[model samples]
Target: MTELPRDRVRELLDAVLDDEASDRDDMARRVYISPFHFSRQFRLGTYESPVALRRRVILERAAWRLRRGDSVTDVALSEGYESVEGFSRAFSRAFGFPPSAAERTSTHWLPAPNGIHFHPPTSLWVDSAEAPRSSMDPTTQMVHHDIDDTRYLLELAGKVAVRDYDRPLLPRHVVLGWDGPEESIAAVLEHLIWSKEVWLASIDGADVPARGGRDIGALAARHETAAPRFISAVQRIAAEDRWGDVLIDALCDPPESFVLGSVISHVLTFSAYRRQVVRQMLRNVGVEADQGDPIMWLRTRHQPSHER
Candidate 1:
């Protein structure tokens, strides 16, 4: 295995998790420096590309979760499998048996085709390599937006409406709707718009108000309104270097207005919850969002720039 310097290795690792290096072109662009130089250093240092490292990390985490007694199903999908069958096949190939074999032993290890073995009670095998970083890596800071490459998965809802075409307001997730504690994507967007104002209040002299839901034509409109608000706030914050601390504090500590979200864990961050809602909505309609690839949508105009 290549011995990677921690910082540089971390950069390569983040690139993989964010899927910035999916294709040869993207991988070349992300590895940066000279292609030959990076390739050699990558092998010498991390012993893997951004991609292999990422897979190793995911599998390691999954193994840890299994040892913690998390259900195999939970571990599978969390690692990004689309279906139980798919996950089971892959798991069997990796572990020599399906995840079911895991339940039999507390700290059993099953060898994987990926070169990494599935060692349960992975905490004991815990390499610092397996720990999740505190703040998202730079590449992952804006992950929520890039992860959903396709804009407005509203087609499924449109189809549903077209089939019957009689629901004045589109039902949230068709299956879940907005009946439970879980808000719809529309609600999540509205909350995201308000979250900016809330964040600003914690920094600038603004006052955080109840989340604005004055009834827009669509959730996109509300999210759009916040773009200008976030732009203005970030611009003003940039003017004063100390304000970076303020934004961080705001990010870390939700204002009183956000207490409801914090309590539910569902309404937390604007980008986070909204991103999750989009993925769920897509799943409900059978769309596989590019959750693994955060840079896929960075080319779009929806960026939240950290003005310097």
Candidate 2:
């Protein structure tokens, strides 16, 4: 499966903030996705339109500066808003008041590591989580781990893949290459989003299609390609606004030679490594990860969950 166009995602963000790539048609073409499809997918994946997401990102950065007492005009320019009025309108829309109001207030609202917070008083509003940026509160580590569990449905797709096909074939396990360690594929994918569900928990991400996927079985009976199925899982994650954005951000401007196999290996290794880290990080706090199906360590050294 292929990921979405990273440059297009960047362009949409920049367009929203700076009009750097203001051509709507170009925006649509860059993702190789239609504007409507693109907009819908962007909203589903990011919980905001390309434009709105960009604005929020801008506001977040601007808010950081505002908290430091950067002037409205300066904040606007920093955010790439053409004029102060333009920046104010967008900022007001995001925060429910103008920058002037923000300046007047002693406390401002925003998310902190484990919770939401307001300045001046520093009141806490939420609990700490694994993926705070995505607002996901999970006990499992965001780092990668070996996984042996497979969705019964995904296995069904794999069975269909070997047969005669007029359609596509999906796999229960997201297979990238027989050449590399299976761990690598899982790791690379996890590094993209840092979601703990798939690699660290018994639960899988919402992006995993339901037991009965989008009529994918029929495709499995057809041309018989697993790539389509894997792509669907990634896109489902992307469209659902999950921590997939973390993955998206990681790839938005990735290094030129992102060795797919080696990276996946690292990602999977991290899961086991992180569980060790989590054990240490939480031991003092009394939040321990009981060894079980998801977290199967062999001896003092880490082992792949597949063997468990």
Candidate 3:
């Protein structure tokens, strides 16, 4: 099979998440490839057909919604299934449990293929290969680690009470960069996401979107979208041996240029600091936030069976 470009594959994956690539022809058109070639390349890269991948993603999302207390009928319709019975059957077959059992059981419903994995609340990620430590490059590993840590932090944020999420955590005059005295836990989280967006746009040579006004749930969704894109962008840069290259920020009046490595380091450092602030804010509001330590999260996620 011919190799498919990773960036194009990322575009197709995003289209899948947006429910805009259901048709093979449409996906091929989006990538400027023929349908046959697109299918061949997709299967070669992901080990699943586009249709199968979409179905699995939708089902995974349905399972997540069910666990989150969405009614079965609503999930069914939202996923485009004709009826609850059909959705239940598909859900049962994919997860080995009927939709009714989702709320009561915490389980990984299906094994993701080699390259692709499901991230909760409706996201699919194309991860690095599962190779021995010596085989993977340092940059790729670091990117994966950051992505995992961010996901863990989002999970912790999900536990914050809605009332506490937007409550002021600092006086209005005390500002952190763009955040001001009206800063709440939500504002801090939003800034964290906004920073990521701006850095990613710089990397991609795209314009940054306007920031703020997103709730906690919307921020989580943005993280889900941004994390994978950032990973793919970093990996592409690493593949091209361009981490040391300078990216000029035309949006800046002085037109500042930053070394790609410095930009990445800044993002990682700022994300850690902001996450800690959010955790502290959650604690002050009586929510039992996790320690938000990446090492602990890694250990729990990849622990040996003997240790367990």
Maximum-TM-score candidate: 3
What ranges in model 2 sit over 4 Å off?
1-19, 101-308
Off by over 4 Å in 1: 1-180, 210-218, 243-270, 286-288, 299-308
**Which regions of candidate 3 deviate over 4 angstroms?**
1-114, 117-142, 172-182, 210-212, 304-308
- The 0-to-1 C-alpha lDDT of every candidate, in the order given, reads 0.43, 0.38, 0.67
> What would the C-alpha RMSD of candidate 3 be, to one decimal place?
16.0
Q: Output candidate 2 Cα RMSD.
A: 20.3
Query: Among these predicted structures, which one has the highest lDDT?
Result: 3
Instruction: Write out the backbone clash pairs for model 1.
Output: 4-45
Weakest lDDT window of 10 consecutive positions for candidate 3: 127-136
Steric collisions counted per model = 1, 20, 1
lDDT of 1 at 131: 25
Model 3: per-residue Cα lDDT over 1-308, one tens digit each: 99965564576566555675657788778877777666545543444556666777788778888888999999999889999999999898677688988999775344444346667755665555421133346555555555555554555666778887787876562435544553677777777777778888777777766664567667766765566567666656666878799999986667899998888878877777777777788788777777866566546435532242
lDDT of 3 at 134: 31
